[model samples]
Target: MLYKIFAAALAAAFTLLLLPGCKDQAKPSETAEVIYHVCQRSFYDSNGDFNGDLNGLREKLDYLQDLGVTSILLLPLYESVYHHNYFASDFKKIDPEFGTTDDYLALVKDIHSRGMKLYMDMETQYVTQEHIWYKDSYNNPKSKYSNYILYDDSAQTKPSTIVFELNSLKGYDGVEHKITTVNLKNKDVLEYNYELFKYFADPNNDGNFDDGVDGFRLDHAMDTLDLKPRLTGLFKAFWSPLLTRLKQVNPKLNFVAEQADWSSLGIDYLTKANVDRVFNFRLAFAIREFDRDKIMAMADSSFSATPAGKQQVVFIENHDMPRFAQVVKKNAGKEKVGAALNILIGGVPSIYYGQEIGMVNGDKPDNVYGPTDANGIPLREAFEWYSGETGKGMSVWYKDTGPWWTDRNMKPNDGISYEEQKGNKNSLWNFYKTVIALRKNNQAIGLGQYQTLPNSNKQVVSFLRYTHQQAVMVLVNLSATAQKAEVYLSASKVPVNRLGSLMSNKSASAKDRRVTIELPGYGVEVFDVK
Candidate 1:
């Protein structure tokens, strides 16, 4: 939660960023969050079927805990023919290949034992042909599920798809998936979604949440059902009521919505829709562009836009879009700079699977029109567990299925695997490990107020994360050249006695409270100030 964001502490500025209903509560040092967004199908395989399973993920809890990841945002695990698992064939059943209900419960229990959260991905806006609702109502208007599934004709034979009435989509696995949109306007469908989500929150009908997920990620969450609304204002009419019922089951269960429009700021989802979080898509794109001015401007606005109790989920890569490593052509320096910002920047941060090890994507798609051009296949490849790219838990489910496998993301002896980088102190994996530790160890970075300090070098992104007692200064050179930056500190707030580098032994010089810092090409450095 982005509980209390303080205003910038510059020489000419001082203000409190208090929002509604937050005047009486006492504020503590805020928590630092490192949310690891993982794709279970590619993470690890325990059953030796070339498909990753719940048992494989459970076995890796130690790895996640050691990296200081406070939460896990898992992609959908429902039994769908598509590899991404978006259009679920069954909402209630865990894919047989993934595991049984017992396996899921055990994983949730283990996550809670380590004080980590597990958020389930729930995309119910559309369903595959095999879903019970679609099966019962596709051609029979008199069926009980008639109002549950959207139809384009009064006959109910023409099932409506989401957005432009698209009845089907070709997935990355080279299959055309016929899908049907849900009639969210129906009272029965609304009740069903709430019940299904609540079941995951407290399975076995027990009040204890140990065997349940901590939250739900609402995929492609919309207010008016793709703007071709049979009912308008679903935020208040549909989503608000649905969420209210779930909160009764678990008041603290977090809800994150993926705004349907990627370009939106998604403030309405927080204020009107009653959700707890929204993806900071604007900032993610700006960071990829890497323009110094754009990053600073967008970062400030995106971090400050949310209301008091809501948070913006900041991230560089997810299951969608190209990986940060692939975007920069595997530049080591740029990779470090991008990874640091993802963790240390304001708001709750998320890292996709294999991102800590700097996983790169495969060849770009030559066409988007056919199953032959399955672009997302490369992005969802197997996790590199060994230097040879072959191991006990290697999940290459699509290895021999397509042409994309010829130039897949992982290569033998590329040094991007966890096996080789686990011991190398300078590797990207350890760099992420060290950065996460730094955030956890310091309250200022995790919970304190944020300020974008002005500096002489335009290429350097300068900022301060400070509490009343201490401050942490972060400097990153966005360009490919080394930069020396000068920033004047505000002397009126607190007396400065010491300034030291947190990531290295390099010294900083100060005179009259002005500081001079040196940053290498695409370098990121943090300093502890007292």
Candidate 2:
């Protein structure tokens, strides 16, 4: 009897081990950690092409990694003709000019292996005129997508008078817009868009997109049209559902809207749409203006404005805009301060491809692309990946590279580059690197409570970041003159041993009742206290 009982007990244990209820189950929860942006390919390449590409970018990973970049926010890699790949022809393949599909896959796999994430820029606005869908829709009148092609309804009215000009509102800047606008009310087309998202999001097509890419930077996210209230409704119908599906597959998936203005509208839409983050175009615009204190004030105000859980994706430049140097022209000093602010302040800071090198568009004549506007301002320039003198490391995109959209080549900004900045202990590059390191190393800096330090001078701005055990003071001098400030910490547990200055690795000192510090023109100082 004892032997029989032992046999039954063992069998029962084995049965329970194979049963669904007894299996180890994963707790379902959705939360993603913060990721800083290492924006890739916002420049002209050296391989004789006007647009930047994959191999050129692969060469710069080490430089980016040295900057303590944890993730890469790549501009659209899909095949397109424009300098910015907003019109995607094929989502499954990388542009042959950029590199092969294998190359892109390898890049993503290698990046992931190294514990870094890659976010692809997605342009859902228009597809190439030659895309299969466009070809099919144009050829097959009976097909479901036939109605997707939007045509001027001049023939609809009883009088049939052409009151509204179709020519004026037909295309994207009149540049061969062929992507048919499908009526979102149509269930079949809505299903196709969802399927497209599923296909791209899926690394393996096992009915669901479980192993797809990490995130998406939705291109032209705000320019939805052809219907009332444009994307706010359609996105909620399509993207919101897809986001929920994607989160189930990978909880770390992130969705970032691009160039979306009207924050209130965007916030309200995205809040219900359940997007993870919204790009802060306002912050970028403010940064361009170099309204220093106003930038901080806006930052504080905007953070308060967003939904309680939503975060902002902040950037200086992306592929579409002119380089950041254009934003702070002849004010390299202010540019540094802007960088410091973006790095230290809340939100994910995105560094454009050429911004770190301080590359500005330089003069190039006979260039279809002209650097100077009617007002004599520099346009987006070719990326100066190296010193002007050519060598083996010269980018292949530049060999036949004509002038860029900005009609210029990358010129040195204050003689700064990643190579130079990495070496200099007090360089702006180092300042950014250190601040990123601090933010990553200290939870207080990343998730702590924020309070703006009182500043009497309008040109000087300061803020305090604190958590239970740590506190940091960030001060920026917005003007071209040195400024003195007295800072007081209400908390009695003041930090000692001076956690040190971020810009210069100089020893930091805060004694007695207050701390007095002097800031250089367009300078920034950080005190990381205990």
Candidate 3:
């Protein structure tokens, strides 16, 4: 009887081990710690020629790492007719002003050696008149590249029906240029773009991703590709196929789409285009106005819409949008509130350069309109490294004499430079650093599940981030007056010892499974729960 009982106990233990293996597996989570979006030309100047370059960025790796950045998203670097580097004249070469191919390769190697990834921006939807394909195909019916670009036959005979007309480049004047859309259906065009993407994904072709960019940001990504009705569904037909081919060459390659429209938030790109990520513009816009309800609702909606494997790129400001500092009138409290929401929210967080120091765009002329307006120039000013006008890492590329540089934004003793904020504990820059450190150090804030918590105060926004091993509670006061609120976590009881303030502008206390915190106007608090 004893021998039989021993055999039965062993069998039961073996069966229990097998049961765990049979259960359904959880989906894998995305792993992007933090992405810093940089406009290279305006970031830093290594040559002191006033233009920021790849070598300039290469020199700042330590500075970036100190700020808890794990990835760098550079704006377009391809040879382009414009300063923004969007209208590419050659996809294979780096812009001459930026640097040579060797410079870019060295930068990539340096970034990877420090355990960080690089992503380049690419917009292949349109081409300037200076592009080789456009130059070769222009009004030349017999040319091999004639079918590569869309053209109107009536434009050849009737000047009034000309589809090709001169237009001013956005953010600059006295520089009118003609542009045409590429024909995505054309086999040659498709093949050319494919090769361009593959080249950047592995420039050396040695299968070492560190030698080249890890991914590409598909600018102006859309389904139709153009305004014409016939162009609809090109993303499904073109992008999906191109992405598949690129992945086969380098399975680790990733793509983030700049969805054409920001009002609607969905996973259509991930589901239909098979892309990896999309910008959460709705959340970004909501955060700008400090709308607590809208921000919480949008955050929850974005989390639900994105499937388990895909991710959303979250940000409060970028090159195209108004600076967060400018929008909030440079209020310290408001800036801190925005920073908390950006770093603590679910999904990957990307910080626009200069945002950490509370940089604001200079006042603009009143008559300007659209992104092309001259007023947009101040939004892309040089980095203020010192309290003075000129110093190390300062790139006054547009100072004193450019179409967009009528007035300088940085003044002496303004206390908005890195030198000023680096030592000040209460500076906006330090707040960003501290919050980012918390996000990086805590796994729950970066990769765990997100849920909006219930609160009676309209001015307070509370949420929970948790995984099996960790849980975090975040509360924010959106108004400009001191506020008090209680966050009830009845569903998940708080452990006595683990309940404490991680980072906050005010004091907080825990009692009877509830967290009661007092926040000054535009204040924020992050708590670690059991």
Worst 10 residues of 2 by lDDT: 157-166
Model 2 lDDT per residue over 341-437, tens place: 6666666667765576565654322222221111111332344554442333443233333224233344444454554556777666676677677
lDDT of 3 by residue, 1-530 (tens): 11111121223011224334221112334443789999899888888789999999999888899888999999899887676777677777899889899999999999989889999998887777788877787767677877677766723211111122322244354465556667777878889988899888888788777887888898877787534554678767789999999998888787998887667674888888879888999999899988988999999899777865678888998877768998899888899989999999878889999999988875554224333434445666887788887887688876666545646577778888888999999999998999899887876786666778777688999987765556678888999999988777665422323456787434455677677777778877788774
Cα TM-score per model? 0.92, 0.76, 0.89
For candidate 1, give the lDDT of residue 452.
Answer: 72
Candidate 1 lDDT score at position 79: 84
Q: Pick the candidate with the highest lDDT.
A: 1
User: What is the RMSD, in Å, between candidate 2 and the native fold over all Cα?
Assistant: 14.0
Q: Against the correct fold, how does model 3 do in TM-score?
A: 0.89
Winner on lDDT (1 vs 2): 1
Best by TM-score: 1
Residue-wise C-alpha lDDT for candidate 1, range 1-530, written one tens digit per residue:
00000000000012134222222111352367788888898999999999888999999989888878999988897888777777789988899889999899889999999888999998888887888888898889899999988898998888886655567767656667678788888899898998899899998878999888989898878888777657578899888899888989998788999887778889999999889899998888888888777777877776567777678888998877678898888888888888888887767889998989889885454243243225566667788989997989898987877667777778999988999999999999999999899888987677655567677888888777765445677888998998988876763233444678898897675678778888889889888876
Q: Superposing every Cα of model 1 onto the true structure, what RMSD results?
A: 5.9
Cα deviation in Å at residue 174, candidate 1? 4.4
